[model samples]
Target: MLKKDIHPEYGPCQVACACGNRFETRSTLKEIKVAVCSSCHPFYTGKRGAVVIEAGRVEKFQRKYAGTRFGKPAQETEEKEQG
Candidate 1:
């Protein structure tokens, strides 16, 4: 037998999305906030853009390591050998 009053109250809840979308649902929480939802999710909207906060990080890494052998640049290694 399940005990009464042991579990928290369950009732209708409201969900608020960051994209300004709100909906009603049933949850333990009275109000919930989320960063993304079906209304604004990239997959659902089919709009894929840069979601990273720090942009250009990937480009910067590739540029810094271009033409490199091991961790050192190929040109630097050749110069050291000649010296």
Candidate 2:
């Protein structure tokens, strides 16, 4: 059984960040830091953009229609007038 104490302790103390970002706060222990804060982080600073790409997608499509007639010019349609 654990008894109630006036103070508590936490792990992972002094978390120094790689982006030179640091701050102080309270958790289950003392002293804590983090890497990549809102000042330079991609997500926090909105610097990163969406990524969209598929493997062999462009190649697959080109191989599927190597020399098809799909690129042909549009066909001319006759127009009729009704009174």
Candidate 3:
């Protein structure tokens, strides 16, 4: 049994946010336009960029300890010492 007179009467059937987010929830009216759109979001825009390169870090380390006893094996150093 559907009663027309007993039904709720809500005005402005549609609601829209300034962020371009639109939704409908049984409003008595209808909205058609929104302001801001998610198309320009940082995540959606794919514009985030980050790059890093350690300039001369490896080269500096190598140059500073080119032929030193830092990483030489124990047997090689022992042979050199014996020789």
Best by lDDT: 1
Residue 53's lDDT within candidate 1 is: 37
TM-score of each: 0.59, 0.35, 0.30
Native-vs-model 1 lDDT? Answer: 0.79
Clashing pairs in 1: none
- By descending TM-score, how would the candidates be arranged? 1, 2, 3
Residues 1-83, candidate 3, lDDT per residue (tens digit)? 87788866765556564555566666545554544334433456565531213235677887889787666788888888899
lDDT of 2 by residue, 1-83 (tens): 66668556644455446566566554675665554555665666776642213335677887887556443333411121221
Displacement of residue 5 (Cα, Å) in model 1 is: 1.1
Per-candidate local distance difference test: 0.79, 0.53, 0.58
Q: What is the full ranking by lDDT, best candidate first? A: 1, 3, 2
Q: On TM-score, who's better, 1 or 3?
A: 1
Model 1 weakest lDDT span, ten residues long: 49-58
Model 2 lDDT at residue 3: 69
Q: Looking at model 3, which ten-residue stretch has the lowest summed lDDT?
A: 47-56
The C-alpha stretches of model 1 lying farther than 4 A from their native spots are: 50-83
lDDT of 2: 0.53
Candidate 1 displacement at residue 40 in angstroms = 0.3
